[model samples]
Target: MKLRYWLAALPFIGIYSGGTLAASTTFLFGLPFLLVWNLIWMAATAAILAIIYCLDTRDEAAHAGAGKGVEK
Candidate 1:
């Protein structure tokens, strides 16, 4: 949707895909542990994204209010 959302999501996607690829390859050699690690990463990523979204929305609303005030 928004560029901000896409930017925020890019890191998580990269981490998940990279982790999956690494786990699938012979570099890590651990499957179950890597899977669990990726799951934890996913959870952390979600939390970070939620926080970012909240902050961004707050900023955007403040900017919109400023613009409205300027128009008066």
Candidate 2:
């Protein structure tokens, strides 16, 4: 994994810690705090994974193009 992938995963670390460290006396829009927080983080993780996929695919295309002239 690259540094960018590791950095992208930082939010997950924060989400896990936040769920454990925070008090349970709060609510968001009638939902429990952790429930809302977990849902938001899940969406964020999905978005980050999508971005990583895009980056990986772009890099693959670039490498394929660069290798085309040498393969003959």
Candidate 3:
């Protein structure tokens, strides 16, 4: 697999490991620790996805630019 694939998996790995770690902790601000942990991970996942999209878009644009003067 490519490096991008591994990079894409990072968020999931973080969520799983972080969640497991957070679950054993106490609550904060009267809210469940797990809830807060999951919410943070969700935001992180969104950011990661956005980064992946931007990278893919950039790659596509570069590829298109490179092919502009090519035949077939």
Candidate 4:
């Protein structure tokens, strides 16, 4: 949905591409890049998840406060 999402995907895409390349080329350096790429991707994913969690919590709190002022 956002550019951040697309940017976040790049590391994972690199990992997959690197892995495929490694299998065929069998290069030592390629393996390290793959591992690093995956690790970076995982970190990015964690950050995104944390942001989503915070946003949800904020929304819930806002709704609760708003509800207190309304009467049916």
Candidate 5:
């Protein structure tokens, strides 16, 4: 797996840490802390996926260009 894939897995790391946070009664941004945490991680996952998609698209384009000169 690529480093980017490991980076993408980072959002899930927050889940294990969430048990400690569940004891808190505080609200985040007017929402429940756990809700906010999940939302934040969800957004992060989307952003990471978008970045991976863009990089893969770029790599594919580069590969396709390099293959254009082949006669067979």
Candidate 6:
């Protein structure tokens, strides 16, 4: 139900679409369209996961005082 869950699903959707994307024989920067799709998805997956990780770390970041030295 969270935003990250929806974002995670996006990359999987791209995976399933590989077959349909492969139908295109277009070459991109000397690489096939399918290869380009896979490369883009790879970066997308990392970015999506990084977002999830940042979301997950919010609680840890909120407890900022716990790891700090006593100021008093």
- C-alpha lDDT score of every prediction, in listed order: 0.66, 0.77, 0.78, 0.63, 0.77, 0.85
For residues 1-72, what per-residue lDDT tens digits would candidate 6 score against the true structure? 988789889999987798696885788889888888899999999999898887786688768967697676
- Candidate 2 vs candidate 4: the lDDT winner is 2
- Whichever of 2 and 3 has more lDDT, that candidate is 3
Best by lDDT: 6
Candidate 1 lDDT, 17-66, residue by residue in tens? 66555545552335455565676677877877777777577777788788
Off by over 4 Å in 2: 1-3, 57-72
lDDT of 5 by residue, 29-66 (tens): 89888888788878877887888677666677889899
Better of 1 and 6 by lDDT: 6
**Where does the lowest 10-residue lDDT sum fall in candidate 2?**
17-26
RMSD of each candidate relative to the true structure:
5.8, 3.5, 3.7, 4.9, 3.3, 3.8
- Candidate 3 displacement at residue 6 in angstroms: 3.4
Model 6, stretches more than 4 Å misplaced? 57-72
TM-score of each: 0.42, 0.64, 0.64, 0.42, 0.63, 0.71
- lDDT tens readout by residue for model 4, 7-30: 567655655665665444433445
Better of 2 and 4 by TM-score: 2
Error of 5 at 2 (Å): 2.8
Candidate 1, superposed: residue stretches over 4 Å from native:
1-31, 58-72
lDDT of 4 at 16: 68
Residue pair clashes in candidate 4: none
Q: Candidate 5: minimum summed lDDT over ten consecutive residues — where?
A: 10-19
- Best-matching candidate per TM-score: 6
Looking at candidate 4, the ten consecutive residues that score lowest on lDDT are 21-30
- Per-residue error for 22 in candidate 2, Å, reads 3.0
